[model samples]
Target: MPDSNTKDQIIKSMLNTAFYKSAGETSLANIAEGVNIKKASIYNHFNSREHLIEETCRSCKEYIEQISFIPSDIDSVSKKYPAETVLKGIVDRYFKMHEKQPLIQIYTFIQSQKYFTPEVMDIIQAQKTALISQTEKVLLSLIQNEKINLDSNDVHSTAMWFCSAINDMLSNYLLERKKDMLPFPEKNADKMANAKSDDAAIEKINAYIEKFAELLK
Candidate 1:
C-alpha cells in the first residue's frame, strides 16, 4: 500500500504538471518521474490515470476553499464592523488569496481544462455560485444590522454585480502578470515595469473597493 506521503507527492506532481501543461498531458510516467518512483507505483494509490486526475482536481478544489475568505460567522462579523469595513476586509483577503502562487497555478490549470472536462467545469461553476451566495449572505446580514440602506429586494442583484466586477478586475490583473512572463531581452526592465504596473493595478482595485463601500453608505 502507498503511504500518505507518497500519495500526496503524487498529487503535487500532478498539480504541477497540469499547471504547466494540460491535464491530458499529465501521464502516469510524468507523475512517476516527478515523484522519483516507478510508473507502476502510482497504481498502488490511484486506480488509473483518470482516477489520479479526478483526485488532483478534488485536492485543488479543497485547497482553494481552505485559502478562500468564506466567512463562517457572517452574523458576528456584520454586527462588529460597519458596512464599509466589512466589504474592504473581504476585498483585502480576496486580494491576498490571489497572491498565492499555488492557488494561481491550480486556478489556471482548472480554467484551461474546464471546457473539455465536465468535472472541471462543475468546480468552476461551484466556485462562482459560492462567491455570489456568500456575498448575498453578507449583504443580507448588513441589511439586518441596519448598516446599509440597500433595498432588500435588490440584495441578490447587488451581490451578483459586486462579485462580477471584482472578478473582472482580478482577471485583468492576472492577464497583465501573464504578459510580464513572456520571454524578453530586457528582463530586469520588464520586471521593474511589471512591478510598477502591479502596484498601480492594486491601487485601482483598492480605490474601486473604497468607492463601492462609500456607495453602500
Candidate 2:
C-alpha cells in the first residue's frame, strides 16, 4: 500500500493539474509524472484514474468545508463575539479561501466538470445547500441573541439572498482569474488593463459584507 505521504502527493498533483486540463485530458501518466512516481505506483493508492478523480473531488469538498466559517455551535459563537465581528470574520475566511490558488483551481475545475460528472454535480449542489443552511444558522443565532434586527420570518430568505450575492461575487472573482489565465490579444489590451485587481475585488466583497451587517443592525 502507498504511504499516506504518497497518497497526499498524488492528490496534490491532481489539484495542480485540474485548472488547465479537462477531466479526460488528465491521464495517469500526467499525474505520475507530476509526482515523479511510476504510473503503476498510483494503482496501489487508487484503483484507476476515475477512482483518483473521484477521490480528488471528495478531497476538494472536505477542504472547502474545513476552510469555510461554519460554526458548529452558532449560539455559542454569537454569544462570544459581536454580530459585526462574527460577520467580518466570516468574510475574511472567505477571502482567505479565495486566496488559496489551489482551492480556486479545484473549484473551477469542479464547476467545469459538473455538467458531465454526476459526482462533481453532487458536490456543487451539496456545497451550495450547505452554504445557505450555514448562513441561515448564523443569522438565526444573531437574531436570537438580539445581536441583529432581522426578522426571524425572513431568516431563510435573507440567508438565500446573502449566499446568492456572495456566490455572484465569487463567480466574478473567478472570471477575473480566468481572464488572467487565458490568452488575450493586443486588441483587448484596454479591457485587460481595465480588469480589477484582486485586492480591489476583495475590498468590494468586504464592503458588501459590511453593508449587509449594517442592514441587519
Candidate 3:
C-alpha cells in the first residue's frame, strides 16, 4: 500500500487544483502528471475519477467540520429562543461556513453530479444521511424543549430542504462569480456593493430563511 503521507499528498494536490484553481476535466491529466508515477498508481488508491472526486469532497467536509463551529448564541437560541431565531441562526451559520470554505462549495458541486451514476448517488446519500442526522439531533432537542415547532411530518423534509437550498445557492453563486464574463455596467454597482465573500452567502441564506419562515404562515 502507498504510505499515508503519500496518499495525503495526492489528495492535497487534487484539492488545490479543484478548489483554488477551479480546474475542469482538462486539469486532471496535469494533476496526474504531478503524481510522478504511472497512471495505474492512482488507481491503486482510488477506483476512478469520481472516487477521487468523492475523496476530495470528503476532505472538504472534514475541513468544514473542523472550522465550522456554530456560535454559542445560536446553540442557546435552539434551547431558549423562538423557532424563527433558531432557523435564522442555523441559516447564518451555514452561510458563514460556505463563505469561508471554498472547498466545501467545490465538493457540493461534485455531489450534485451524482445523478449520472448509481454509485455516486449512493455515496451522496450516505453523506446526506450523516449531515441530516446531525441536524435532526439539534432539531429534536429544540422541539423537545418546545423552542421550535418541529415534529414528525415535515421536520425532516424541512431540514433537508434547507440543506439542499443552502448548498445549491453557494454552488451557483461561486460558479457565476467565477465565470469570465464581466458584469453589465448597470449591475456593476450592485455587484461591487455585494462583492465581499460573505455577502453572497448572507444574501442566499437570508432569502431562503425568509422563504422557510413563510412556510409556517
Top model by lDDT, which number? Answer: 2
Query: Residue 105 of model 3: what lDDT?
Result: 39
lDDT of 2 by residue, 1-217 (tens): 5698999889888766655565667788878888899989999999888888888888878876665566566688898888878877776666456644567667877887787778888788888888888888889889889889998899999999998998888888877766675454323535434445578887888888888989998
TM-scores of all candidate predictions against the true structure: 0.78, 0.76, 0.61
**Which runs of model 1 end up more than 4 angstroms from their true locations?**
22-27, 64-76, 176-197
Candidate 1, residues 1-217, lDDT tens digits: the string is 5698999889888766665456777688887887899999999999988788788888878876665465788789999989878887887677656644566557767877787778888888788778888888889999899888899899889998999998888778866764554343222333523433477887888888778877888
Model 3: pairs clashing at backbone N, Cα or C within 3 Å = none
lDDT of each: 0.76, 0.77, 0.57
Residues 1-217, model 3: lDDT tens digits = 7666666656666654444344454255645655666666777778787777677666655654454334544456567766666667765565545443344434544555456445556555665666575566566656666665656576788778767876577567655544422342222335533544546556766777776656653
Q: What's the lDDT for candidate 3? A: 0.57
lDDT-superior candidate, 1 or 2 = 2
Better of 2 and 3 by lDDT: 2
Off by over 4 Å in 2: 2-4, 22-24, 65-67, 70-85, 175-197
